[model samples]
Target: MTDRRGLLIILSSPSGAGKSTLSKRLLEWDPSLRFSVSATTRAPRPGEVDGKDYHFMAEEQFKHDVIEGQMLEHAHVFGNFYGSPMAPVQAAIEAGRDVLFDIDWQGAQQISNSVLRDFVLSVFVLPPSIAELRRRLESRGQDSAEVIAKRMQKSWDEISHWDGYDYVLVNDDLDQSFEKLRTIVTAERLRRAQQPGLLDHVRNLQKEFEEISA
Candidate 1:
């Protein structure tokens, strides 16, 4: 195995679409997958680790990275700036570890347009139904009724771009969705584009074949 670079898996979904939850489950089940820790200007919630849950940075520093082109993709959500930094992601790929991106459509576009595009595997997770999405949002209890309403309003806009992704997983159930994600990751690792050294490997096998006949 060449240990060639791994997929830049991008999963985007509206709030309550179960993407984050599903991402957690998939990583739990798969040891090789690594989550991309985003940099955020928002204050960390309880129990969140600085480098694990997010790399909390000051707004000035966040803006500085954006200005300097250090971010792969970034978006402002509810008054906070959240972004994926370029260096760490590129370093991970160069080290042959699969990096995951849990970003929205706008960020996904920014990433897909960058050099990382060649290695990207974009997956959009969709709610099974609007009703189910509303139900899930309500259960979280962190959002007010007004905020939940806003989230529900944006889901249609978010999911409308489903066709742009390489794969779509309907997150009706957590375990099933994780399996679907896992399947995509596994299949992409064997894709021809990921294996430029394949021709050489095959040529060596062909010589062995000729030797057998001789």
Candidate 2:
């Protein structure tokens, strides 16, 4: 069989909807999957590794790249710039390696409508309830009360875009949601359009049958 084209799998959600954790789990489940490391102008967090967590860059450089059309999708969030670089994503997909993106709805919308839309599989994760969402955010202990309030407002905005995604999951339980996510990936990989080699395989089968009949 010929190599199948790689999928651009995107996961988007509100701040406390468990999208990040699920993304990590998916990466662990499929080691060959390439995670789309985004470029950002924000300062790195305490434990964030450069290039691994994010490709931290100066604002000037980031704007330069954006102006040069190197970014696949970008957004200005919370006074900082964040975007997916096109070159790395193209290289990975061309090599038949699926690329996973953990981004917000704005980025996802840009990519979903881009020239590479055919290869995109976008999923939106939703929290079970607003109350639960707040609880999860508080549990993290990473944000101050003010920041948390800001995020809560932003979360509502994010959740409003849920209908834009190809797949939607209400993440009431982590394990079940992950299982559903895995199933979606598996099914998408098996899609007829994703498997270009199927045409050749079917043609070969036809030829073999004709030869046997003769």
Candidate 3:
């Protein structure tokens, strides 16, 4: 079997954008793809598992890991510190199992510029329009009006970093956006598989063919 390195797939978007929904669908589409479980200083909500949902830690411990360089990517958002642990991502990549990250632009930037930058494939999702974004956020019925207003104010900050990503998708339609996302992952996996070892594999094949002809 040909050996191939795994991808650190990142999806970033504003609060009302469909990145999280798309990420969930992508995981369902490919069971082998591991979701990069992030470590957070926030307290877990009901029914949220510790390691499975997130690696819950104290603020001191989280900062210690960041200082020790144990976090692949870390960021402060909405008063909580979130980070991706380096060990699991590195291990998964070494074993050629793709890891998916549904993080914000800050975390994405950190990962994109890391030593593992070569393994990163970052994509940003954009809302079709500000009106549509507001509508979606309001429809969620989750956050209060003030919080929604704040998110809208910060939306442009996230959208402005769209150019930093390898691919940008306007998620007007969830199914279409998901199809494109799937295609991007499939192509990246194929590309990663065609490493320098492929040359050797081809040369061996040619040698075998010549031996049979002789």
Instruction: Name the best candidate (by TM-score).
Output: 2
Better of 1 and 2 by lDDT: 2
Candidate 1 residues lying further than 4 Å off, grouped into runs, are 43-48, 77-80, 196-214
Across residues 1-214, which tens digit of lDDT does each residue of candidate 1 receive? 4447777999999889988887787677777778889999999999999998899999999999999999998889889999999998887777667888888888888898987899999999988899999999999889999999988888888988888888988888888888888888889988887775687889999999999999
* Candidate number that wins on TM-score, 2 or 3: 2
Query: CA lDDT of 35 in candidate 1?
Result: 89
TM-score of predicted model 1? 0.84
For candidate 3, give the lDDT. 0.91
- Per lDDT, the best of the predicted structures is 2
Give per-residue lDDT, candidate 2, residue 97: 79
Q: In candidate 2, what are the lDDT values of residues 1-214, reduced to their tens digit?
A: 3468789999999999999999999999999899999999999999999999899999999999889988889999889999999889888877777999998888999999877899999999999999999999999998899999999999999999999999999999999999999999999999887888789989999999999999
How high is the CA lDDT of each candidate model?
A: 0.87, 0.93, 0.91
| Model 3, span 138-173: residue lDDT tens | 999999999999999999899988999999999999
